[model samples]
Target chain A: MTQPTYDSLKVGDEIPTLTTPSVSRHTLALYCGASGDHNPIHVDLDFAKKSGLDDVIAHGMLSAGYLAQMLTNWVPQSALRSFNNRFTAMTQIGDTVSCSGKIVEKFEKDDEKFVRLELYSNTPQAQTIVAEAVLVLA
Target chain B: MIDKKHIGYNFPPVTIPVEEGRLKFLAKSLGETKAIYTDPDAAKAAGYPGLLAPPTFPFMLEIDALDLVDFMSVLGETLEKLLHGEENFNYYAPIYAGDSITVRKRITDIIDKKGGALQFVISDNTFTNQHGKIVAETRTNYVFRHQ
Candidate 1:
């Protein structure tokens, strides 16, 4: 599907569903390289155990990244002004993360169409209410 | 008591280049397969000019390319103890591949959560592209180990 433009949108809309695959060692390593957030807990098993986990854990931000993927597909690419989420549970190496969003409000600001949204992320263990975001389009 | 006197305290801005390699690295890390994030052809299929960034791609160094090291340096933060409690992004537009961004960081809030799961310090960052367009707004909360 093509990325949506500023128009063709309305208030009180819901973004489509997206699923994030299970965590993997290679994926965690790649995240560290991109985010510059090389916390051993996310990639090193020994460090994770020392930190008191069952095994190497996924980066909290990476778990949230799942929501980002959902947002980009639901809204326009880069039309997303900001995407945010909260980490409520520990996403283990084998957990699945799914995401969705709902438009909370819409208003006109400075002659631009602005939409406020509530984004949600769900893990096997818990549901995390990630964040409230606002987007402005011309 | 919180003080508004320092409300406007600003961290220096840092500049960083948006590279195709970095975006691909992030997509690979998140186990993402969207063509927009990895393949220019797929992006074109999606009606984008070319390969674009994943939604959270700007959460990295691209936002800090304007000499804003202070955002990366929290005076009282310890790497051994620092934890990211939460993150929130407010989008104004899509951020794609080959886009350059600069990030300006500042302390937005700091409160002791009363020895709760974590004491929170929130920072607000603003990202501007190479064309000096305000591309995004980021607010992040850092959970410091409680004393």
Candidate 2:
């Protein structure tokens, strides 16, 4: 895949959207092991139910990881200067997520080129996770 | 009600070594197809010193040295009511395999909302490499919901 050059990117350019496979219980389990975030709300169905949640939900970081993957897959890993997101809703198992972003601003500072983006992810149920990111380009 | 006194509490620092195998696992788990994240030769060809960590790889590092359960216990809250609310990361330098990074965490803010039914605990963490250069900073907010 060809990377986007600093010259090629401009304000209002849309990043290719990424749609993930359906989130599964097994995936959540693997994430629990990998992230060391063993909160029962993410793994134990009984615990989640008893706690008043509909079911075991995906870790917020897991969804954040997907959004980061979307960015790094397009730009070089080293080019990312910052990434942030607010978890607006729970990502339940069996939900498929789609991530999209658009360049909102472009500027030059200290002889370095930077692009700022407004990013977001949404589930099938219309729940959204909003994000903002800044990337440096050569 | 959330205690505002815990603000400014700092946790013990933890040093974590970035391992190549763990990097690969993280990439695979995230379904990343980047060769630089898992292939040393690909990273070298891309001008990196060694295996490259994915943008959010720092999430795998055990930076929260304080026990969440114990911390919540002191606050008279239970882990069952906790939820992740928001997260942010600022990258100052690239992290590569074989780098030992030290992380320091501090509680920066606590807010009570919804008439004390919901509380938020915000923490800021700094990551420094073996040479003592700051690599990244992360801010996280965890929400506690009371029934």
Candidate 3:
């Protein structure tokens, strides 16, 4: 995909969405080690039940990583100026996450052109995360 | 159970050198297929000094620098009842492999909501490269549910 130019973007342009296969325990264990977040609630089922959850849930950052993946797919990591997310719902095991984003606004700051995007990752059950990102446009 | 006195708590600084293998591992774990994240030659061809760190890669570094379980223990909270509420990052510069980064974090605020059933602990972290320049700053909110 060619890099998006500042003049070619509109306020409501929707970015191509990214969808993942159903989240699995194998993926969660990999994330735990790779992310350095050894929280038992994400890996230990007994612990999760003790936490008042039926089963282990995916790490919030892991879902955030999915959003990051979607953004990086649309733009290079270097163009990303800021990324933020609020966890609205838990992503249970076996849930597939779909991340979508739409350009919200375009502006100039410090003589650099920028675009703001409203982003979210959702499952069939709930909207797992909502995010906003700012990226530089060349 | 939220206490304002812990609002000013500061964690000791931790310095970690970025490694190419670790970056590649994290990128692969995220299912990233970009060459810039794994191959140093490809990264250099793309004008990057080394393996390029992904956007959310800093989340792991921060937690490695300061363990979240340790942080929760300081507040008298257990891991089973804690949940991540939100996360934010502002990048001022790119992070490449071989850069030694130091992180410093401090508790910024503590708030109670839902009639004291939920408590939010907000913290801010600053990451500085070896050159002593600020590279990125992150804000993280952790929520605890009182039973």
Winner by TM-score: 3
lDDT of each: 0.68, 0.83, 0.90
In model 2, where do residues sit more than 4 Å from their true spots? B62-64
Expressed as tens digits, the lDDT of each residue in A26-65 for candidate 2 is 8888877666677788999999998898899998888788
**Could you arrange the candidates by lDDT from highest to lowest?**
3, 2, 1
lDDT of 3 by residue, B39-93 (tens): 9999999999899988887777788898878887788878888999999999999
lDDT of 2 by residue, B69-144 (tens): 6667767788788988888889999999989999888889999888888999998988899999999898888899
What TM-score does chain A reach in every model?
Answer: 0.82, 0.95, 0.98
The DockQ scores of all candidates, in the order shown, are 0.49, 0.70, 0.88
Which regions in candidate 3 have their CA more than 4 angstroms from the true location? Answer: none
For candidate 1 chain A, which ten residues in a row score worst on lDDT? A75-84
Expressed as tens digits, the lDDT of each residue in A19-58 for candidate 1 is: 8777678778888777777667778888776666678867
Candidate 1 chain B worst ten-residue window by lDDT = B63-72
lDDT of 3 by residue, A8-119 (tens): 9999999989999899998889888888899999999999999999999999888899899898887888899999999999999999999999999999989999999999
